[model samples]
Target: MPEDVEDPMDYIRLHLLEKLQVLLTTAALLAVVYFGLGRWFRPADPLGPIALLPGGELGKLLGIVVVLLVLAAVAAAATTRSRPEGALMTALFGLGGVAMLSPPMQTLFWSYPASMQSLYLQMMAEVLIFAVGIMLAEGLGGLVRSFMAKICPRWLWTNTLSELSDQQRKTLKKSRIDPMWDKNILNGDSLSVSSGVRNTLLWNLLSLSLHGKNRTAAQKQVFRGQLHRGFGCLFSGVLAGIVLLVLLLQSPERGQILFALFGSFVLAALFAHHLFPVRTFFVAWMIPMLTAVLFYALAAISGTGNRPQYQVLPIDWLTGGAGGAILGFWLSGRWREIRIFEALAQAPPE
Candidate 1:
């Protein structure tokens, strides 16, 4: 096989190991923070009274185990070809995380000593906010994309395609030379190539058009068209961030709430990049950062008395947005590969 064509089993094994490492590392860090450092950072629980089991420390350990199991399941599911299943699992995990963090549930299940309650609450709150943000952004962005694809002007898609470089166009054309190309590529109804070469070509073409240097006039036109379409996602992300901000405002920890807002913005942008046809990294990163900054500026200007100091730092914003964008790009590529695999699996035997 070509070096670029990875065996599916190898891919699965490599990613599964990575996920396990991440899961283990995260669990260990959490344990250290909760058990080792909890006393040092103890404060009043901002989330207020939480439920706790009668079993004390042992019960908390069990609950933590359950949470880890859920996370493991999510990670495993994410590596599979079933995007819907992965997304559903993620949503469920998010919901469960939030419920577990709730005051009643926290009191009932969590074993944090009174001194550590504040720190525990803070940790769980961060997890809950991230989960909720991801669920909402991905779900809402997908819905919006589907809706827009149906009603949006044809010019957008056409212009975007027209922007492809000659080389990229040739690659696309070459991929479509097969007998079943019309039933697949043109219709956008099915995958045609058994090797996934077509999908790879398409992905590379788009990436080059969006990110490659020395773009021709046509490529620039495509970039503009993509930018226009990407505005829909930009709007969607901003709206989602605003909603998260409002929800977070209800929480007692104002600083953490703003942090969640920033997180939501990043998630929104990542979801938008993954779901929308526009594949540009600039759009993926800048839209969310700009949206957050714009909202923050407006809030600062409008507020009375001392201007509210924005809690989100530039380093945090850059890191989060860039990380999310890179992940989105990677996922997009993986999805293309998966699509090719499926198409090949379904194609009639020679």
Candidate 2:
């Protein structure tokens, strides 16, 4: 009866359309991640004969990855959508441009491709990674915050909260911290540790403080942008990276001896952020770590004598995992930070 109310058929139609949009977007993104990573790491099977670094295509694969990410960033600039959507849209177009330049996907569309058993199994494991990471980021982040507050020294929190710059104060306002409770964390209830929610606030404030304290003015500006971007936004980029990796392994051109060396990044949002950074990086390392373990376990379970002639050895995985995870986490975080700054910079100055 009112202008605000919609007809039932109209609602059904719109809901269907929305579902269709999600379906198309998911497929497109799945294509982009799968094809992009496949083409990049063509030379190294990680599970097959090609191998990874030290003896394989790790360096070359990595070099190409940096180039493609830059390409992705450039492509993202062309998208009018918001941050995460822009990133995905960029990947879609970036994959197209890549395919045009190199139609190497022919061999992959082989009529009789290698057995997908290993890859499928790997995919299952990856699904686990995403399930754990995506589902837990909110809960685990809060939990870890509480855990940190419960264990961390009161002095550290007091010191961090005590010297809140105007920007820091604004950040709290932006985060919607309760004024009264914020005051408690800052100056009240000195002896009693804050409850979980309050402790969560303390941990985030502490994160902001720790990350921004020694930064240069420009860097601090970026850090403030990161604070505004918030951990969830930063984690979205991390989510995109892991999603890319998960899709990477599902390519039609596959062998059991597989490695998504290109997409290896902080699998961290799965467990936890920046200490936080380290924890996040550790999770990123899980991409490769899980890949390595899953394959080895699969091999053992199958009792296959066709052991992989790994060019990328365990050491390569460990070091690559460490570097890639940390770097990926930092880069994704930085991208979100810069993007937030770009948006904020356009607003009328305070």
TM-score, every prediction: 0.39, 0.29
Q: Could you give candidate 2's per-residue lDDT for residues 37-152 as a string of tens digits?
A: 54564454323322223123446434433444443343323221212222322332333322222222222214214643443344334334322332223233334334544665
- Top of the candidates by lDDT: 1
List lDDT for all candidates, in order.
Answer: 0.38, 0.36
Segments in model 2 whose C-alpha atoms lie over 4 Å from true places: 1-259, 264-280, 305-312, 343-350
Model 2 clash count equals: 12
In TM-score terms, candidate 1 sits at 0.39
Residue 60 error, candidate 2, Å: 25
Q: Quick one: best TM-score, which candidate? A: 1
lDDT of 1 by residue, 1-350 (tens): 12322455544554454344434533543454345433322224544322222222334433433443344344323322222222222322332322223332233224433334343333333333333333333334234323433554321111122232344333443454333222223322222111111122234456666667777766565555555656765676556555655555354333453355445655565566445544333344445456445544553454311222233322233333333443453355345545443343334433
Stretches off by above 4 angstroms in model 1 are 1-10, 14-225, 229-232, 252-255, 305-316, 319-337
Error of 1 at 126 (Å): 24
lDDT of 1 at 198: 18
lDDT of 1: 0.38
